[model samples]
Structures are given as structure tokens and as C-alpha cells.
Target: MAVELALSADTVRMIVQKARAVSESLPDTYEDGHEGDLSFDTEKLENVHHHDGLAEEEHDDFSESELREIIDDLNVDEATELVAIAWIGRGDYDQGDLDLAFAEARERSTSPVSTYLLGLPLLPDYLEAGLEALNL
Candidate 1:
């Protein structure tokens, strides 16, 4: 069965792309524990003076900020569905239980949807799985 959404497919696709970018880049940028080290690297500092700008790999602020903006722009129902979709994707709920998922998403939400969604490290994968499950 095809799942209909008030939110456009293009919007969801764009979100998926952004979420994937952020998720993929997070480990190297945030979890590596070697990015902003300023200990005793005099030679590295010499090379840094020659560089024009900060390296892209050093941060994912753009993608992550864009994602937060996109989610923040979504209406209440749209955001609720998005949460439900992620839940479904993560196997917390099934396609047939979409309405139930929606209810839970709405009822259980204590923080902003974007905050909740962004906390999930596998958000992109879950969203993709949810979309496929819904045959969207």
C-alpha cells in the first residue's frame, strides 16, 4: 500500500539527503577527537598559515544547520509524521501501525521535533527504511 503524505516527496528526499550528509560526516568531524588539537604542532601551524580557509572536513555545520532549519520549518502534522516515519523505519512501529505511531510521536514528544530527530544517529537510514516500508 502506498502511504500518502501532506509533506511532499521532494521535501522528504531533500531532508534525507541532508540528513545522510550530516550523519555520514559526523563521526569524522565530531567523534574523531583529533580535529582541533593545538598541543605541540608547530609544523602543522606553519602549513595552516598558508591555507586560505577552514577545511570542510573540520565541521558539518552547514548540513546540520540546514537540516535543523528544514525540520523547524515543517508544520505540526508534518513534523509528527516525520517522527512517526522514523519510528517505523527503526522497527518501533510497522506500516500498518502508522496512525498509532503518529499518536505516540505526538504524545511522547517533550522537546522540539528537530531536536528529537537530530539526536538519532541513524536518522537517515531509519527514514529511508520507513519510506520504503510505506512504499512512498
Candidate 2:
């Protein structure tokens, strides 16, 4: 019951859980300039790292695809709301400033929403905090 959001709080929670799984699966640090060089283990969202000498094409494997699919499945409004929640959670805006946050999220979402959101570390914590702040 996220009163201020377009999506259900439960739906947002599920999305955050999926995003957290994606974040937890990734390596702790990507080289600042070479952010594109990343890959993951064959299992679930865990043990991700750079495999030496792997081709760039090879790097776009399952874990990322799984995350993309998870986010891709959401309706446009839900996706937009999730981004807003993340922005609030990350302290980019006060809970009362949700309209501005939502506007920024939509304007900034030029890339695949999943790629953008998954790139954020601590997404789950941020989202959870935002939801609490909203008293969802």
C-alpha cells in the first residue's frame, strides 16, 4: 500500500528483491573506465567477476539477461515508479518531493531500465528505506 506510488508496495518489494539479487551477484568493483567488462557465474545471483580474456560478446550472458527480463516484464508505470522509489531511497529527493523524482527518473531513463537500476549498488536498502519513509 504505497499511497504515493502508482505501483503496489508489494510489487515494488518484489522488484527490489530481484534487483538486489542482481546487485549481489555482481563483482564488488568494476574498473572505472572499463565498466562494461563484467560477467557472472553459471548459478544464481552470486560469484560474479571478470573472467580473463573473455570476449566482450561473451560478457553479455545469463545473469544480466535474467535481470533485464525481470525488469522488462514490468509495465511502464511500474518501471517508472520503481525508479522513483530508488531515487527517493538513495536520498536524491525527500519523500515529499516524489513528483520531481518521478519526473527525473523518466527523463533520465534513456537506457534499458534494468541496466540502469542494476548498476546501482545497495538498491534494495535504498528502496526499503524509501518505502519505510513513505510508510508503505
Candidate 3:
């Protein structure tokens, strides 16, 4: 089956690159297998507690803000597709479930897509994995 993305592969790659810079700039505070993890899987992004130590001021604002701007600039359809890709990468949904993931992303989104995505501990990795899964 052929899957199409509202967001281009180049754009996704750029986001992943920028997000990786942001990820590299931040301190590593996440741990694996914490109780009450909000993420879908255990080993993937792991527990949210790892992000507890990272205050807003702790991250590289320039890089993060750049990424935020890029994400925020995306149309709702593109943003929703981005979320679906991440979900696929994070194992919340399989490649064949792209449509379902997109639906869930759109239906479940309550906050800014940028805010929700940037909040993920392993955004770059997940996005990269998502790209690979989609064979883009």
C-alpha cells in the first residue's frame, strides 16, 4: 500500500534535524520503566519524570523556538499527519494504521501540536523512526 503524507518528507527531515539539535542541547534526565508513564510504551520515550528536571529555561530556547515556529506554521492537516507519524514511530500505531493514527491525532489533540510534540522526550528519534516506517 502507498501512504501519503500531508507534510513533505523534506519538511519532516528538517523538523527531525532541528529537534535533534534541541534534544542534544538538553540534559538527559529521562529514565526507563517508570510507573504511570503517559507514553504508549515502556522503553520508547519512557517515563515523563525524566523531563521533570528540564525546566523551560533549561533548554536551548533558540533551537526549540525555531522548531516550534516550524511546527506551528504547519496547517492543521500537516500537523495532524506529523502527530500520526510520531505515533507510528512510538509504536502507538503501526504503519498500516496511519489513517487511524491521523484520526486519533486529530480527535485527541487538545493543545498546540507544537507544544504536544516538542514535549515528547524523544521527538527526534521517534520522528526518524516514523519516517523509516513510512519508507519516506
Best by TM-score: 3
Q: Order of candidates by TM-score, top first?
A: 3, 1, 2
Q: Positional deviation of 51 in candidate 3, in angstroms?
A: 30
**Global Cα lDDT for candidate 2:** 0.62
In model 2, where do residues sit more than 4 Å from their true spots?
27-64
Candidate 3 lDDT by residue in tens digits, 20-88? 878766644334633121222223222222222222333454477777766776766777788889888
Top-lDDT structure, candidate number: 3
Every candidate's lDDT = 0.68, 0.62, 0.70
Query: Each model's number of backbone clashes?
Result: 0, 0, 0
Clashing pairs in 1: none
Model 1 accuracy (lDDT, Cα): 0.68
Error of 1 at 53 (Å): 32
Using Cα atoms with residue i matched to residue i, what is each candidate's TM-score against the true structure? 0.71, 0.67, 0.72
lDDT of 1 by residue, 1-136 (tens): 8888865555666677778877765544224432221111223222222212222224445577767766766666677778888889999999999999887776775566676777677888898888888898
On the 0 to 100 scale, the lDDT of residue 47 in model 1 is 23
